[model samples]
Target: MIFLLSILTILNYNSNSIEINNAWVRPAGKGMNSALYFELKNSSANSDELFKVSSNAAELVQLHKTVNKNGLMEMKEIKSLKINGNQTIKFAPGGYHVMLIKLKKDLKTGNKIGFKFYFKKAGIIKADAVVKSY
Candidate 1:
């Protein structure tokens, strides 16, 4: 039946083609800066680029990379992060991460922060990152 076929298609599309796992944000004290880390997996046979990220808890959310410059660590804002088809990208400390700029409030452990990741091909993926104390 047409209805049955449509439902099946939708289910297949949502069946973890692109998934987020182990998402967490570092707890920041009074500082207005924070970082979020997660693992992104792309199971579909199409490459996608994460272009945008937004969060209500921060004034600005941007993709960033940590680079060592002159034996010093620096954070640089990047435009987008690419994830090839069937590839997994890890966003972790000392690597690629989401920079939460000008946080509205201090991040505390056991709290949840909502974020929306926009992909070029696969569309938008919403995730809640739990705040963790380091």
Candidate 2:
């Protein structure tokens, strides 16, 4: 499926060996919340940890995960995420995702938002996510 392929691409790289693919953000109005999804691929022999995420488009950007708590879906903030060497991590709906809180401006369809991913080993990896609607 297309969704599976997109996830594969995201897990495909940060530095020379870590690549990000199929990065995107959900469209939202100013002062509203949005979410970013992507695939992070680690191709190096060494493992890496994504400790932080930053984006000027929102007042606050944090790593989050959706969980089923007592049959109710809840979103929780996560401190960090790890991706082993030669592995891939997918940030998707109902899973691990980036929470964009309090948008500074409207994220319309086709708009691009800049992001910086902080990794323990890879350092800061800059990426742009396209605003889209599912």
Q: When superposed on Cα atoms, how far off is each prediction in RMSD? A: 3.9, 9.5
Q: Which ten residues in a row have the lowest lDDT in candidate 1?
A: 7-16
Pairs that collide, model 2: 10-39, 10-40, 11-39, 11-40, 11-41, 12-41, 13-18, 13-19, 14-18, 14-19
After superposing candidate 2 on the true structure, give the runs of residues whose Cα lies further than 4 Å from its correct spot: 1-14
Tens digits of per-residue lDDT for model 1, 1-134: 99999887566665358898999999986448899999999998767789888998888889999999999999899999888879999999998999998889888999999999998766888999999986
Q: Write down the worst ten-residue block by lDDT for model 2.
A: 6-15
User: How well does candidate 2 match the true structure in TM-score terms?
Assistant: 0.88
- Per-prediction TM-score: 0.85, 0.88
On the 0 to 100 scale, the lDDT of residue 132 in model 2 is 93
Which runs of model 1 end up more than 4 angstroms from their true locations? 1-15
